[model samples]
Each structure stands twice: as structure tokens, then as C-alpha cells.
Target: MSELKNSPWITCFLRPQELLLLLMLRWAIAYMEDPAFPHLGDSSQPLPRACPWRCSCPRDDTVDCAGLGLSVFPDNITKAARHLSLQNNQLQELPYNELSRLSGLRTLDLHSNLISSEGLPDEAFESLTQLEHFYVAHNKLSVAPQFLPPSLRVADLAANEVVEIFPLTFGEKPELRSVYLHDNRLNNTGLPPNTFLGSEAITTLSLSSNQLSYLPPSLPSSLERLHLQNNLISKVPRGALSLQTRLRELYLQHNQLTDSGLDATTFSKLSSLEYLDLSHNQLTTVPEGLPENLTILHLGRNCIRQVEAVRLHRARGLRYLLLQHNELGTSALPAGTLRPLRALHTLHLYGNRLERVPPALPRHLKALVMPHNRVAVLGERDLVSARALAELNLAYNRLASERVHPGAFRRLRALRSLDLAGNQLSRLPEGLPPSLRSLKLQRNQLRALEPELLAGLKKLRELSLAHNRLRVGDIEPGTWHELQALQVLDLSHNELSFVPPDLPEALEELHLQANRISHVGPEAFLSTPHLRALFLRANRLHMTSIAAEAFLGLVHLRVVDTAENPEQVLVQLPPKNKGALSPKG
Candidate 1:
């Protein structure tokens, strides 16, 4: 065997399956070289049980023969298999030690059977000293007994009828690292006062979805990750993680963390921490003094109001900062508030009470989100258009005028999409970057759209002018004579009284929702032979026939979003211009 393994010619001449078997045999020989686990031979057998399952096992260290309607454990199994799974059987009481003859057993999974918590004997698992993993989850255990292994590293007692953990139940397993005690009847107050008497050996812990409003004063310093999310955790011990210097990731999201619970020193000692998620909480005020090493901070869907991240200047590595849905007004961000975070790329300040625009924003920011705010003006010279800015979203603001400075976007040559929908604007602004591709101005107060406002956008492809007071007379030949690259045009939610003529030649998506359009005027969409994704949702149309030639006019019409139209609007199937429409249709 040794000569064959070292022979280079054997590797080149053997098939894949033959080579794999030889490699596995050689690997096992090298791994089991320990004097305690000797190899067996055909002539003179040694450690004969280890040869029974050298292969053909379902998973690593686990062998499942459960629900086979057997009366006793499979006696023909090998000793090398660490875990033996036999669940949902007809055993009333575990005949302890009958299966413990194999001293190499590491895990014993016996769940969903007729074994009750009261039926467990005192010395059930006391003999299995080498056992490090056990799974009794989803069983009929009501009261946990002191039956555990001293060398245990992980134990799953979850999804059981257990009421609480006794103080002495896990006291023997001082080396236990992970424990799953969730989804049980263990109340915070009903815990055995000394449940964590020797819990210092643990590194990763989870007590989520429980009745815990607070935690114990002391925790294991070796813990690197702790999850206390989705529970009644309203408060934690002062500087709860102060001693956990090695902690890298902590999940406390979806908890009731208020100002009192989160303070400046909450993460003062967590210098090694990297990822922290405190989103979906009732934090009314901004939590200050965050760990400087934090990379991704998710504070979205919380009650955080002001941009009062006092010491956030230290978070230089922050890439994504989400502060959506709060009482944050634009005034809260002082001049140069975000200028230091040059590395920041994505900023979500949506759904706030911002009154005016901000200045001196991060120059290298890629995404700028200020949607659903009370913004009336995107202040001039306030914050120079960052050339690196790609997406600008100011949707659902209170902007009424064309106050956006022209130079504000000249430097933003990377701007691809601009959303100014749900605002009070009557007309689009100028100085739109030449690189602009998409502009969303839906649900605005515009009565007319001047052609020159959009003629400068040479690369403009998608434009949404829905929910406006636009009239049919607002259309003309110069509407888009210069924009040869125009494609998707949304004119929905407007009081358009008439249908225009000869829309953009490349027009694809046309929206005319919530309008008073009565005339499907002549030459309408005649230039658009590649129109698609047309929407006529909610409108009053006086032109009922919508001539059969009307839809046959366009060649590439597809995906018409006219599902929710008002009673007055008429519907019709559009035409297709072979190869004239987009290939995506």
C-alpha cells in the first residue's frame, strides 16, 4: 500500500473513481495513525468496528437510521461514526449504556420520540464523557434533568416542552461553547439563579425570541458574537459589552433599545467590533459614540430623529449609513457634517421632516437619498454637485420651484437617475447633467412642461411626468426634437385635456394616468415605432374608438401598465414595429 501511494505512474494511469478510493484509504491511514485508534487488517482484525463505516455515511460524524421501526440501536454500525441519530421510535425509556459501549461517540440525537423529561434517569448521559454534541430538540421533554456530558461543546435543547433550565443541569459541562435555549417556557424571572454559574467557557451565545427584557450583569469575555434580537430585550446591563473586547459582531436589532439603554459608552469598549445592527427599534434619539471600527450600521425603520451622531466622525470606514424614517430635518445636518466621510458611498436619509436642502455633503458619495422629506429647495452652491454622485433621489419632497442651481449638476457627470416625484414643482429645472439618463417627476404640480427644460439632457432615456395638471396644448414639435435618445415617457396622474402629436420617435413607455385627456390627437405616437410598457391608468378620455390603427402605429409595444384606470379612459392593444422596438420586449 505504501509503495502504491508513492508511485507516480499509478496516479496518471488510474481513473477518477479508482484514484479517489486510493486517496481516501491513504488519507484515513494518515489520520488514524494515533496509537489509540489502530487500523484493522483482513488477516488480523484490530479496531474492527471502525471499518464498518469508513464510507457510505450520510453526513460528517452523523448516522441517521431513525423511524426505521426498530426496537434497538443499529448494532452493526462502526465506532468511527461520532453521531447516532434515532428519533421518533417506540422507545419508552433510554436503555442507557446499552449504546454507550462505543466510547468514541460524540453526538447522540434522539428527538420526537416518547421520551419525556420526567422519564430521564439521573445517570443517563453521565457515562458519555467524550460526547461534545447532542440534539434533543423538538421532543416531549418538559422538565430538564441533570444529564449532560463534561466534554460537551454544543447542546440543542430547543423546541422542546422544557419549562426552565435547572441551575445544576449544565454545571458539569464547563467547556460547552454553544447553547440553544430558545422557544421554551423559560421566563426571565423563572431562570435558575445560577444558570450561568460556569458559563465563562462559552464564546457564541443566543437567547433570542425570549422573555428577556434585560441580561445578566456578567458575560463571557471570550464571546465574539452575541444575538439578542427579536425578543423582549428593552434594556441591557450598563456597558453590557464593555468587557467583551474581542466581540466582532453583535446583533441587537428589532429590540426596544431606547436612549437610556444605548449611551455614549455602550460601545466604548467594543473596539474590535465591526458589524452592529440596531435597526427596527424605538430609539427616538441618535445613539452616540459608536465603535469607530463599525463598517455597516443599519438604523433604518427606527424612531431616530436628528442626525446627532456626535462622534460618528471616527467611523471613517463606514460604507452604508441608513437613517430612514425619522424626524430628521435638513437643518439637523450642519455645514460640513458629512464632508469628513469621504469613503461613505451610500446614504439613506429618506422619510424625514427636512425643511431645506443640505450643504457640504460628502463629495465622493455615490447615492444621495432625501426622499419623503419637506425639501422646498436644493440650495445653490450649498453642496457642489459631486462628480462621483451617480443616483440622486429627492422624491416626495415639497419642492415647488426650479431652484436647483445649474452648476449644482454640472460636476455630477456620473448622475444616471434623478427622481423628483411627489413634489410641488410646476416645471423641471435646467442644468441637468448631460449624463442624466432617467428623470422621475411624477405627482408634481406642473401645468406645462417646456421643451428646453429637458433638451439639454442628450442621454435622457426615461422620463416620468405623472400626476400633474398638464394640458394637451402643452405639446409641440420641439417637445423632444433635440432628445433623440429619449425612450420611456410617463405622463400619468396629470389633468392632460388633449393627446399630443408625434411623440418622441424612440418613445417606449407612455403613462397618461389620472388625466382629463379627451382627444387622442392626430399623429399621436406616430414617430414612436418602438414604444413599449404603455400605461393609461386612471383617465377621462373623450376619444372612445381609439382607432384600430392607433395601437398598430407603434411597432414594439409590450407590457402596458393600464390595469387600474378610471372609468373615463379607453383601452386598446398596441402594435409592434419589428426590430423597431427594443429587443427586450
Candidate 2:
């Protein structure tokens, strides 16, 4: 070869075109003879300079084509793309070989489309060997798409029309960790035994809003969270969850679970369980054998009549317990039933038939809701142990003012809100906590308000005294002077003939609708400079009684409702301003 190159005949005798062809032939021969040459067939083509039309390439490896109303996938997408989002489009199909070039793709989102099972072929995702997360939710898929990548870790198929899921639908996907199949039509017959036996690595599985009538015993042992809410499941046989020892959360609300269907031994083996939701079921009593580490339990809207202390003794770590809308009565809860719940912080017992409050509440309890009951009395010992209580709701009950003990709420120094509306109270209860910020006393029979009734409520901000029999002399002078923080007061549906005097200067809203007030003067709102809303609707005011400048001092007053009074009375008030007054007829 050196001797041939040294001779000048080859270069001097050949034309330019022939010389180029000779060099190309020599290069090709050298590549064929040498085994160390790298393959350059795929990389020889230059990458596209710009992203596809109507799409954005924020990075060199990401493509966002969401919400484009596209009926077909874009052509010639860069094969180097690792993330592609085509959600909220009109595409209906994912045919085979359509994504063959995107073998390196790791995330693909096709949510909120019209794609069905038939639109996606068996090998639609065969080439995506490196895919990790796949989202196909909110579509029209009637069956599980086949040939999902083995490397997939998360698959979302929620809000679809999938009626059946075969045992091998997720064929041998050992790396799959989360599978969302909620809002489908899957029933017990469609889900055969061992449907999830192959998915050992699945930690979260959502099968909610289905027609399953029984709990499946084929759940994987490594599963940690399972959601089966809004299903028709009526039975949970013994040892149903024996294999799932690592389960931590189970949601079975809105089902047909009864006391007989739920065997206590089924959950004793799940030592790691922390949350359980069995609300809206048919059980007549609290379930037993709950895990000791449980932190939350929801059993609302059931037919449970009793909650025995033994049933909750093992769940010492429970912090939240909801038992509202049941058939429980005063005798249903025995004494010391809640004493073992040392960590309980929130308890909901509203909408029951109890005639008295439960005793021995946890000292650390923060929220206690017991409204819509038949309790007629509130004794001093009702809440003595709840020193840390911040919220207490006892509205819509049969409580009478004479029945409440004077020191019923004196121990609750941390109380901030107290609701006692829709009762038969004739007077204000004594010894109310001074830390109360909100007090609801509406729809009662109170006839007067003395100065001593609100003497220590310096932090009171809102007070509702509507729908009472209070008259002009009901409110004494300086009745609300101590409540410097008072901002809202509602005295509507009363018999008061005039605006009460000595209101707090910080008052922002005053409601006195359906009263007998027939006159108003300019000094009516002189003390309330920050008043923004004043309602005097359905009063007995005449057109000539109200002074034109009655609201002049209220610079912040914007909303005034004087309707249902005479139209002549409305014409006597001052002309409405653009930003100050918005009087309604």
C-alpha cells in the first residue's frame, strides 16, 4: 500500500469525480475489514432543529402536547424524548408501531382522552422497555390494555369503563408498585381468584366505586394500602387479610358490611394498620380486634347502637374517632367506655338519640361535636375533664336554660367556640368561659339581656341572639360595653322597638330584621364607626321617622337591607352612594 501511494500515477492520471469514488471505495473496504469500527447507521441522521408545531419542548428530552384537541398523534417526534404528555386531547387510538421509536421514554401521560381498549393494540406499548410511569385515566377503556412494559412502576386507569381484569392483565410486572383501577365496573365474578397473586411488589391498589360484593382473599402479601370504598362488598370473611400483614390503610366506606360479615380476627394480623374507614355501613356495633397502632377510625352513618370499652381498649393510639349519625342513646355508652382512649383528640357523636352527654371524655380532647341530640340538661360534670377543649357544638338539641348547671363550662379555659342554637333556653347560661370567641344562641326564648350576663366576655367577637322575644327594655345600658372585641351581633326576629344603645365601637355588622323599630335618629350609629353592614328589614319604620343623615357617620357601611318595610319608608332614607351605601328594597 505504501509503494502504491508513493507512485504519482494514481493522483495525476485520475479525474476529480473518479478520485472521489476511489477514496470512498477504499474507506468502505477498510470499515468492512476492521472489526473495531463503530456502527453509525442510526446516528448519521441529523436531529430536528426545532420542536413539532403546536407543541413545546421546554427541555431537550421533554415534550408537552396537552390540551391541543388533536385527533392523531404527532408525526416524527424526537426519539430522544424521555417525557411526553398528550392529556386532554381527542385522540382515540394507540396503534402498534406508533411508539416504537420511543424506546427510551420513561413517562407517558394520556389522561382525559377518548381511547378505548380496542383502540390500543396488544403490542401498543411493547417497545417502551424503559417506561416507568404510565397514566391512562379518564378514558373510555373497556378492558385492561395488554403488553404493558415490565419496567412500569405506576399505572393509573381510573374513571374508565373497564368491566373485567384478567389475572394476567399486568403480566409478570414485578416492578409495578401502584395500580389505580377506581371508578370502573368490576364485579366479583369478573375478578377471579388470585387476580393480584403475581403483583407482589404492589404497595397501593385502588378498586373503589366498583360492584364487588365480597372482599377478595387474593390480595398480595406486600400490599400496604388498599382502597375499596363505594363498592357493594357485603362480606369480609375470616382470615381475609391474613396474608397482607404489611397493610397500613384500608378504606371500606359506603359498603354493605355488617357485624356478621366483618370477623374481628380478619384484622388482628394486620399489626401495621393505622387507618380504617368503615362509615356508611350496616353494622350495629363497633368492630373488634382493631390494630393497636390505629390513629384514625371512621364509622359514621351506621346503625351501631353501642361502642363497648373492650372493643377500643386495644386501640390506645387512636386520635380521631367518628361515630355520628347512628342509633346510639344515653344508655348505649357505658361509664368509663372512653377512659382508655388517652390519645383521643377529636370525637364526633352528633345526630344520635342520646338524652345526655357522654361522660369521662379524654383530657386532651380538642373538638367535640354532639349536636342534633335529645339532651335536655347540661350538668357541671358533662365536660369537666375536657380542660383542653377548644370547640364544642351542642346545637339543635332540647336543652333548656334552667337545666344547664352554672359551672358547666367554667373549666374549659381554652374553649374558643360554643354553639347552642335551636334550643329552648329562656336565659343565658352562667359561668361561660371568657376565652369564648363565638357564641350561638339563636332560635331560643330569651326575653332579656342583663349587663352581668356578658360582663367577662372581653374576647367575644360574634354573638347571635336572633329569633328571641327581646323587647326595647330587654337590653340594659352598657350591656355590651365589656365586649370591646365584639364585631358581629344578630338580634333579628325580636320585638325591639329601637336600635340598642351602648354597642361596641368595633361592631362591624348589626342585624335587627323583623323588629318593631318605628324610628331612627342620626345618633343611632354614632358609636359604631367601623360598622360595615346594617340590616333593618321588615321593621315598622315610617317614611317620615328616619333621619336623612342616620347613616352619615358610618363611612364603611356598604350593605343595608331595609326591604319588606313600606316603599314609602325607603324613599325617605338618604340617596344611595356609589361606594358607601347599597340599600336594597
Candidate 3:
């Protein structure tokens, strides 16, 4: 057998079965050396693909060379690479001759580069016939690139110095769907009426943060989302949107639009419109003749004084309404102003002049955010219709504890989070919903925390009473017993002389910073064995006042901050693997 394995003519002296096995071994060796057969016995286990230097190939078809700071494009790019990302570089030009070599290229991203219009020849992208997505945003192009590939679907040219767009800049691109040209120098005269006429399939066009002073007279009829915010647009002619029946979302915030500047019938013909934003304008009333299918409307930061239900009568499907930072008063919002909007889910009336909660709110509302208003009281039946209410934010209001009706939040069974911070409440409000999980009462005049205030709050996990007048005796005994699920308790910026007792066992973080705490007893954290973080900065603590066994029961404590104390106290902490004490500064 040894002689047969070494001899070149072994097959001549082998038996019939042995001769057949030798022939099969010779055939396998030849197959292994063949270049066409690159797999290791199975096609699924192919060799690794080629990758270029200073670039990463996450997939065989994708190449990411972003944030390499390369002044020139890298060489040796794979021919089969379909997606090439060269963003956040200093490349000044794109060599079309070399780029044209990638015939199968589908996406090319050069965003945040120094490429200018002079570097892009008229036929710079004509050779990339298979290209679909082209991103050149944050460049120095003074003019948009003409002769774009006909197969392009998304074109991003935002954050450029572009001042002009030729009539054929986006022409003959039937597959185009989105065009982003925001943050440019394009004005009303710079955009020709026929610039996008040939791109019939365009659905989203963003022209925000521009120098335009008026609405474009002509736009693509197939646009579904049109963003024209942060412009100088002051007027919308009668037929400005007459042909945009298929439009769904329109953003016109931070413009100079006024009631007199907008024609009454400008947006009446958009039958498919669902979202419209006219915030930060000079309108004194809601726009009339809104689309019937409109669901969300943003009319905040305007000069509007009243909201006539007749103007919103057409928008029966409206769900989200924003009228914050306006001149709305008690008489501005009538009782039935929002009754017609049965589908309204969220309403924002913050920073208004209203003295009380509006009546006849939507029944199915989920959130009512009216912070920074002049509301002095909450009526008992104000929220009776909104049984599905979950979040209520009345922060920075004049809500005193006595003025808040006992049953104001009784009907809101689904209330989960309530923010009443920055109020004049000396005591906790009564009749809080038992389903609440998070309650914020910071920056108020709260002096006491009675046990009855938290009787049914078993699901409450977070309670914040910072920046209040709370004292050690103000918190009644067994006050925290009802909050079995409490994980975070904030008593910072209070008059507590020591750590409060009876912290919940599930408490994980305790914040007592900026307090008058002078000592910590050995049993301070006995009930909170699972505490992970403790903050006692900016207090009157001394090194001798903190007992050696103060944190004995806290095995999971990870962070203990006692900086800015009277004597720079540093407590002995657990091992490094468990936790460490933050150094005093």
C-alpha cells in the first residue's frame, strides 16, 4: 500500500476496486484546483469578496466610506458595488469617467462634501442609468444639477448654496418620488414654473428655509407631502392649491402668512389633505374651508384671538389640534367650539390667556396639554367626557390646591401621567386617578405630603416634588407605603434635615440634592435594599455626621454623590465591582 501511494503508475498494479478509488481521488484533486469552482464542496460557503482600502464592505453589494476625511475618492472600488456612501468627506469633485465604470450602481451619497456646481459637469450623472437615489446635500453647489438620470427616484440637494434651478433640472424623471431642496438661496424668481413639470411621479417636495416671498404659482399635482416652512411667503392665491386634490400634508410654519394675505379658497380644493400646519403666522382666526379629511392642524404661535367653530366645521376628521402661544381667551373658545371634532385625540392650548379649562372638549381625547396658561381652576366636569384621557399637563399655571375641584380628575380612569409642576399648590390635589404611573409636581409650593394623597397610587413608579417647601415633618408617616411600585423618588431642594424614612423597597434612585440634610442615620436606607443611585450634593453634610453603617443595607448602590457638602464628606462605599463613591470636588 505504501509503494502504491508513492508510485506514479500505481494504478497499473492495483486491484479492480482499488484502481477505481485511485481514479476518483485524482479527479477530486483536479476539481479543487479549478478556478471556476470557488466554493468549498458547497455553493453556500463561498470565499470573501474584495473590498477597497479605507472603506468597509458590510455586504457584497454595499460599500460605506463615510467620515474618512479623504480629499479624493478612493480607488479599487468593486464593480458590483450598488450602494456607495462617501459622506462627510472633503472631496471637491466627482470623476464621472471613473464613476461611469460602475454601470450597476443604484445609490450614490456625497452629502456634507465640498463639491460645487463647477465640479459637476452638465453630463456628470448622465452615464449612471441605473442610479435611483442621489444625495449631494450640504455642498457648495450654486446651481442644481441638470441632466439627472431618468431612473432617479430620490434627489437630496439640501443645505447647498444653490441660487437657481433650471427649467429642466428635474425633467424627464418619471420615476422620481421625492426632492429635497431646502436651506438654499432659491427665491421666487429662481424657481421656474416648469422646473418640475416633467417629474409627474414626484410626491414629496421640501423647499423650506429659503428666500421665497410667495407661494409658487405652479406645483406638481401628485405631491403628497409639501414642506415650505421657514420662508418669506406672505400670500396664497385663490388657485394656489386648486389642482392639489391628492395632497395629504402641507407645512407652512414660520412664514409671513396672514389672514388677509391668504385667499379664502386657497386650500378648499384639497380633498385628500389630512395634515396642515399654519403655525407662527399672522392669522387672527383659523383658516376657512379646510379639507374635510384633515386630521391634524397646527395653528400655534399666531395672532389668533378666537376659534370659530364654523371655520373648523369642515374638518370633522381632525384629531390633533395645536393652538398654543396664541391670544386665545375665555371668550375666544366658545363652549361648542371643539364639540364637532369628535375624533380629536390631543389638544394643546398652552401659553394662552384662558382663565379656565375650556368646556365641551372632545369625548375621545387622550392628551390635554395646557401648560403656561392663566388657568386658575379646573372644573369638576371639565374632563368628564374624556374617559380615555391618559396624559394631562397643566404646569406653570395658577392652580392652587383649594381652587382645584376634588373631582376634577375623577372621571379620567385612564390617566397615566400628570404634570402639575410650577403651580401654587401648598398641598396635594384630591381625587387623583388610581391608574396614574408618573406624577410631576416640581416647582410648586407643596409643604406636606399626606398619606391619603397617595392611598390608591399603587401603580405609581415616579414621584417628583423638587423645588418645593417640603420639610421632614411635612411628609406624614406611611406616606410612601401606598407607592409599592415606586422606582424613582425626587425630594431635592427641600428643607429635610435628614434622609426621609420608609422608602419603598423597589426604590432604585433617590435624589436629595440641594437640601438642608445634615446627617444620615444607619437605618436611612434599610427599606431600600435595591437602591442603585443616591445624590446628596449641595447639602450641609459633614464627614462625622454620615454614619459608617448608613449605606450598609444597599448592596446594589452604584453611584453616591456627596459633592459640595459643608466639609467634603466621602463615605466608604462598596467594592469597585459593585459600585464606587464619586469623588468630592
Candidate 4:
């Protein structure tokens, strides 16, 4: 090949039509193969898009057409290049003999096309015994029999028309490890008991969003991950699921899994099950005899009123718990109920009937979502000690005071964001964490903001004080000066008569949707370097006041949401340009 590269006879021996045919074949082959534009060494600037035919290089071994939307598979592609991809196109069929000549081919991807099963080159793939990594997703395959590769390791046939599958469908491809059969028309009954008989070493099987009503009576024992979500499975067989003892992740969400019918003994055999999701069901209570090795458990959006912690206490390794929108009403959680969950990171208890905040929490609790509860007040005395808590969402609770305990959040050294929106706060609690970056305190009855109240939050970014009783007398420069990183400020839905010039640098994404902000000072955000995505949805300010240059410093500003009050934004971007921005308010 090196000697040929230096030969002028090599260029002389090749005909232009022969070169063109070989190049077109190579181009057809290369055009079908998807390759992300490469960067120079470690640099980030992507290479410009172009086909290899456009390159001045003398080599005719490579073709590239990654983003072109071509129709009809390129003809005689295999005679030149070994890899082929026609990604992001509307091609209907594969050109005849185009895939056969590429005996040296290793990959073929017809991703995002209209190639149905008939259009699929059924016999062509079996000939490429040297082929590996076949991806034909988002196509029209009605069954799993058309394409078969004995030396396959990964077969992604998702989002197809496969209606049924048989055990011999794989036909003893023992090396196959991953099979993606999700979003197909296959049902549980359509698969035979030994459907996974020969493929015993397969690990991941995704049948989610299919017609599977229950687990097949038998499955591969080496199965590690089984995704059966969004199906009509009402009952999991007792002996049917005992084979997959090594299964780690099991997704059963959006199914009609009833507590009365599911045999507890079936799940008892899965000793390695770590993740379990049983959300969005009609069960009144969970079945007993849960696995002891489970780690993550999700039982949200159900009719469960009572929780028996003793059954789950055996899972000493349980980490994350999600019990939202349940009826854990008024009942006291048993002592040491969640105490053993030492590895717990996130516990969601929102939309419950608990009238009192629990005084005990895990040592590793990071995110506590307890919004929309019946608790009327909150302070350090009621909140459990979670020094590592970073995001606390206690919005929409009935609180009337702002005198939270001085040490309420001082211990949370890592606390960065807090959402107290839709409360009845008259003032901010004392001693908030200084590391906070985002604060949401809208829809309250506070009369004004005390500039001295917030002097230590140096990392504050987005603060929404909308829907309050704010006034110009409440303004102070220290409040804005202390927030060195303030990007978005929402002071709308207040009684402000004059727009204050107190915002510091980097005040982008401001939301003054509804207020009496009659004037936006010329230097309102003079120092703001990256101000963008503003929302003055509603105010008494006129359109002319917001001259074309009124937003002069915001070179990065692209979207301004003013749709909530048409009279306010239309008074600004008049006539009919109001329909262009994202949904406002």
C-alpha cells in the first residue's frame, strides 16, 4: 500500500469511471455509517461536516456522509468501504448486492429510517459472519425472525413491529449478552416458557411498554436486569420468577400489580434484587416477605395507608425511599423505622397527611422533599438534624411565622438551595446557610425585604420574591450587594411603584411578572454581564419605556417571557411578535 501510494502508474491504471464507481460504492457504504465529527487531538472545535469524496486525499478507501438526508439506500456500497451508515435519513429499502460485496464489513447501522421487515435485508446480515454491533432500531420489523446473527454480542431491535418471539429465534447464540426488545408488540403469552433457554448468559432484557402481562414461567438464570414497566401485568408467578436469582434491577412501574394476587414467595427467591419499582398501582397495602438484599425501593402514587416497617427492616442496605402521594396519614412512624437506613440519600415524603415533621432522620440524608404536608410551622426543634442536607423543598405548607430556630439551617454546611414558595412567611428565618445559590419564596404575605436580614449569602443566584407586599421603602443596596452571584431576581406581584436600581452584577433571568414596576432604571442591570431569559410578565410599565436599547447590556438574552399579561408584553413587543417566545407565566 505504501509503494502504491508513491506510484503515478497506480493513479494511471485506475479509470475515472472505475474510480468513480469504486468511490461511489465506498461513498454509499460510508454514507450509511455514522461517525461523529472528530476534533483535532484534544481540542473542542468540531471538524466541519464533509464527505470523503470532497477531500483532496488520493486514498479511495473511506466515505463519509453522516448528516445528509438521503433517500433509497446507496447502490453497490459494499464494493468499496467496509463500514456503512445512512443515519438520519428517509431511506425505504436497501440497494441489492450493496451489502453483500463488503465481506470485510464489520458494522451496519440503518438507524432512524423507514425500513420495514420486508425492506430489511434478512438474508444479507446472516452472510456477514464477521459483522458485530447491529443497530436497526426505529424501523418496521413485525417479528424477530428476519435478522439473525450467530456471532452477535449486542442486538438492539427496539421500537419495531416484532409481535412475538420464540426460543429458537436466537437459535443458540450463547455469546449474546444484551438484547433490547422494548417498545414492541410482544406480549407475555407470545413468548414461550423456554424463550430464553439457549441464551442463558444474557444479562439485560428490556420488555417495557410491551403487552407482557406477567413474567414467563422460565427465564435465563444469568439475567441481571429485567425491565417490565408500563405493562398490564397484574400477577407475577410464584415459581415463574425463581430462576433469575442474580437479577439486580427489576422495573414493574405503570402495571396493574395488585397486592392480593402477587405471591410473596415469588419475590422471596430474588436474593440479589437491588432496585424495585412498584409505583402507580391500585394496591391498598404491600405484600409481605420482601427481599432482604434490596437497596432502592419505590412505592409512590398508590393507595397505601399503613406501612409495616418490620417487613422492610430486613433490607439493611436500603438507601433511597420514595413514598410520595400516599396515605401515610396521622399514623406515627414506628421508632427505628427508618433509623437502620444509614445509607439513605434521598427520602421523598411530599403530599402526605403528616401533621408533624418527624424529629428523626438518617445521618446520610441529602435531599428531603416534604412539601404539601399539614405541618403548620417549622423550626429547628421540629426538623431532624441533617447537617449534609443540600436541597430542602418545604413549599405549600401552612406556615405563619418566619422565626425559624436560629440553628434551623446553620448546621447544614452544604445546603445550597431552598424552596419556601407558596407559604405564609412574613419574614425570612434567621441564620440561613451562606452557601445557598437558589431561593424560591413566592406567594407569601411578607410586606418587605429587610436588607439587613440577608448579609451573609454570598453565593445566592436565583431569588424569587414575587407575589408579596414589596415597596420602595423596603429597598436597600446591601441586600443586592451581598448577593455577589445573583443571576435571576423575581420581585413581581408586589406593590412596587418604582423599579429599584439595587441589582448587582450577573443578574440574569429576572422575573418581575406582576407588580407596579412602572420604571426600569437605565442602569437597572448595568453591571449584569450575562443577563438573559427575563420575564416581566405583568407590570404597569409601558412598551415605549422598554426601548429597543433598554435591554442594551444583555447580549446573551434570547428569550423574554411576557405572555402572562399580553397587555404588558404586547405593550412592549407590539402587534403580533408575542407568539414567538416560550410559554410565559
Q: RMSD in angstroms, all models? A: 11.7, 7.5, 7.0, 11.1
lDDT of 2 by residue, 1-585 (tens): 445434557777899998887777666766655765555554664454567689999998898999999889887678889999999999899756767778889999999999989887767577889999999999999988756877989999899999877666664789999999999998987777767656789999999999999997778888899999999989997778988889999999999999999877968888999999999999999988988989999999999999999999999999999999999997888778988889998999989999988888888999999999999989989999889999999999999988999999989999999999999999988888999999999998998888888889999999999998999797888888898999999999999999988789999999999999988887888889888888888998766767777777566777877778765465233344346543566
Which is the better candidate, 2 or 3, if ranked by TM-score?
2
Better of 3 and 4 by lDDT: 3
Local distance difference test scores for all models = 0.70, 0.87, 0.89, 0.71
* Candidate numbers, best TM-score first, in rank order: 2, 3, 4, 1
Tens digit of lDDT per residue, candidate 1, span 324-400? 88767656777766666777888888888887656677778889888988887766565473668889899988776
TM-score per prediction, in order, is 0.72, 0.87, 0.85, 0.73
Which residue window of length 10 is worst by lDDT in model 2? 569-578
State residue 132's C-alpha deviation in candidate 2, in Å. Answer: 1.5
What stretches of model 1 exceed 4 Å from their correct place?
Answer: 1-124, 127-147, 150-163, 166-178, 182-203, 262-264, 280-284, 300-310, 329-331, 385-387, 402-408, 481-487, 497-508, 513-526, 537-544, 550-585
Candidate 4 to truth, TM = 0.73
Query: By TM-score, is 1 or 2 better?
Result: 2
Model 1 residue 174 lDDT score: 81
* RMSD over all Cα atoms, model 2: 7.5
